[model samples]
Target: MTSEAKETGSGLTAELKELCQAVSEDFAMLASLHNKEPDAELLRLLRDERFPEGLGLRLVEERGAQAVAFMQRALSALPDQMGQADLDELAADYADIYLNHGIQASPLESVWTDDENLVCQDSMFQVREWYQQHGLMSTDWRIIPDDHLVLQLQFLSHLFAAGKTMDDLREIARFMDEHLLRWLTSFAERVAGRCATPYFAGIALLTGAYSEELRELLVSILDEPRPSPEEIEDKMRPRRVEEPVEVKFMPGMGPVV
Candidate 1:
C-alpha cells in the first residue's frame, strides 16, 4: 500500500479505539450511577452540560429520537425545584426498583433468563468465568453477584476500552451475544415500565440501545474480506433437505446449535 493509504488506515484505527474508550467510560459511569442512591453530587453531575451531549447525541443518531428526548427531559428535571423531599422520592424509586424484595425488575441476568427467575445461577457463573479470562475478578463478589447489571456493564466498558485485537473483538461479540444482549433488553423494558423517574427510564433505554449499537459496530469492525470464488460456489451449491429434529432448550444460551 501507498504511504498515504497506510497513514489513513492507522488514523482510522486510532479514531475507532478512542471511540470505544469514550463509550466504555459512558457505560461505566452510567452503570455505576444505577448501583446506588442518587446523591447531590450525582445530581450535579447529571445537570452538568457535559453529562449527556456526547453519548446522548450519538445514541440519538444510532437508536432513535424518543429515548434521547426522554433522557434530555430527565437531565432538565435535575435543575428543577427538587427539594429534599423530591430527592428522597427519587432515591426511593431507585431502591424500590433495584433493591427491594420481589422487585418488578431484577437487574441480574439470571433472573431474566432462568425459568425460576433466580439470581447467581449458571449465567452468573458463566459471566464470572468470562471476567476472569479477561483478568477481572469481582471485588464485590462476597455481596454482589458477578452478573449484576453494574458489574456486567462495567465489564463491557473494560472490554471495549481494551479491545484492539481481533480476539478481543470476538470475545466481546460472544460475551454480549451469549450474555448481556440476551437479557438486558428485557431488563431495560422492565425498567421503563417500572421506573417512576425518566432519569432511570432513560438510562434503561440508553443501556439497551448502546449495547446493541456497539454489537453492530463490532460486527462491522470484524467483517471478513470477500470469500474466494470456490468458497462462494460451495456455499451457493444446493444442499439436501434433512428431517427436522426435536430440540431441547437451554435458557439464555440461545439455540443449542
Candidate 2:
C-alpha cells in the first residue's frame, strides 16, 4: 500500500476501535447499574456533572432529540443524593426486579434461551469457554453464573478494550450477534414491563437501543451480516458436551494464586 493509503487505513481502524471502546464503556456502566443500586459516583455522572466527550453525550447527539429528552427525564428522576430511605427503596426494587429468589427478568442467558429456562446450563459453559479462550475469567463466576447479563457485557467491554487484531474484532462481532443480540431486546422489554422504578426501566430502554446501535456499527465495520439467533444456537450446541479445560490467569485480569 502507498504511504498515504496506509495512513488512511490506519486512521479508519483507529476510529472503529475507538467507537467500540466507547460502546464498551457505556455497556460497562449500564451493566453495573443493574448489578446494584446507583451509588454516589454513578449518580454524579448521570445527574450532577457533565462529560462533553462522554458516551452518553455522544449517544444523544447521534440518536437525536428523542434520546436527549428521554435521558433528561431519566436523569431528572434520579435523586441528587440517596438518603437512607431512598437507598432502601432502591434496594427493594432491585431485589424485586433482579433478585429475591425469583424475578421477572432473570439476567442469566440460559433462562432467556433454554426451553427449561435453567441457570448454569449450556450457555454458561459456552460463555466460560469463550472467556478462557481469550485469557479471561470472571472472579465472581462462583457466586454468579458465567452468563449473567453483567458478566456478558463486561466481557464485551474487555474485548473492545483489549482487542488489537482483525481476529479480535471478528470475535467481538460474533459474540454480540450470537450471545447478546439474541435476547437483549426481549430482556429490555421485560424490564420495561416489570420494573416499577423509572431508573431501572430507563436503563432497560437505553441498553436495548444502545446495543442495537452498536451492532449496526459493528456490521458496517465488519462488512457482513450478523448470524440469526437460530444459527447461533445451532453453532453453540456442540460445544456444550466438550470437556472443560483448566484455566490460566492472565496479567491485569486479576491476581494470580
Candidate 3:
C-alpha cells in the first residue's frame, strides 16, 4: 500500500477504537443504572453538572437531540440533595419496575419474547449459550437469568471493549439483532409507561434510542445492510422441534415401553 493509504488505514483504526471505547462506557453506564437503585455515588454523579452534559453530548452525537432532552428532563426532576424519603421512593420505583414478582416491567428478555411471557424460558438458555461461547457465565442463573437486560448490556460492553477486528463488530451486530434489539424497545416502552420515576423512564428512552443508533453505526462500519424485521424473525426461528412421547397404562400397573 502507498504511504498515504497506510496513514488513512491507521487513522481509521484509531477512530474506530475511540468510538468503541465510548460505546463501551455508555453501555456500562446503562447497565449500572438498571442494575439497582440509585446509590449515593450515583446521586452525586447526577448532581454534578458536567455528568449529564457530557453524557448528553456523547448521546446527541450518535442519537439525536431528543435523546439528550429526555435525559435532561429526568435529571432535572431529581432533588438537588436527595434525602432518605427520596431514596426510598426511588427504591420503591425500582422494585415495582424490576424486582417485584408482580413487576410492572420486567428486565428479562424471555419475559418479553416467550409465548407465555415468563422468565427463564428458551431465550434465557439461548443467551446463556452465547455467554458460554465467550467463556463467560452468570454466577447463578436462578438469581439472575442470562437474558436479563443488565447482563445483556454488560455483555455488549464487554464485546465492544474487547473487539479488535471487523469480525468482532459483525459479531456484536449479530448479537444485538438476535438478542437485545429484539425486545429492548418493547421493554423500554413498558418501563416508560409503568415506572413512577421520570429517571427510569428517561433512561429507558435513551437506552432504546442509543441501541438503535449503535446498530446503525455498526452497519456503517461493517458496510452491511441491517436485516428487516421479517428477516430477523426468520433468522431467529427455533431450529429444533421436540416430538411427543406416548405412554400406555395397563389395568394392573402403569407401563411404558
Give all TM-scores, in the order shown: 0.77, 0.78, 0.84
Model 2, residue 116: what's the lDDT? 84
Q: Which candidate comes out best when scored by TM-score?
A: 3
Instruction: Give the alpha carbon lDDT tens digit for every residue of 95-141 in model 1.
Output: 87778833489888878776688887777888888887667877876
* Model 3: residues with Cα > 4 Å off, grouped in runs: 1-12, 49-52, 61-64, 101-103, 239-257
Tens-digit lDDT string for candidate 2 (1-257): 00111111222377666765776787777677778877666766777543212464255425433444565676677677767787677678778877763346887788887878878877788788888876677776667788888888888877776666666778788888777777888887887677767667677767777777777766767788877777887886644476766677997896453
Q: Relative to the unseen true structure, what is the C-alpha lDDT of residue 19 in candidate 1, on a scale of 0 to 100?
A: 75
lDDT of 1 at 171: 72
Backbone clash count, each prediction separately: 0, 0, 0
Ranking by TM-score: 3, 2, 1
Off by over 4 Å in 1: 1-12, 60-62, 79-81, 224-257
Q: After superposition, how far is residue 122 of candidate 3 from its true place, in Å?
A: 1.4
lDDT of 3: 0.79
lDDT of each: 0.72, 0.70, 0.79
Worst 10 residues of 2 by lDDT: 1-10
lDDT of 3 by residue, 1-257 (tens): 00111111122387788788788888888888888999766877865764445652155454545766877877777888888998888899888877894445789988887778888988899888888777778877788889999999999888777777777788899999999999999888888887888888877878888888789878888999998878887777676677887888888897875
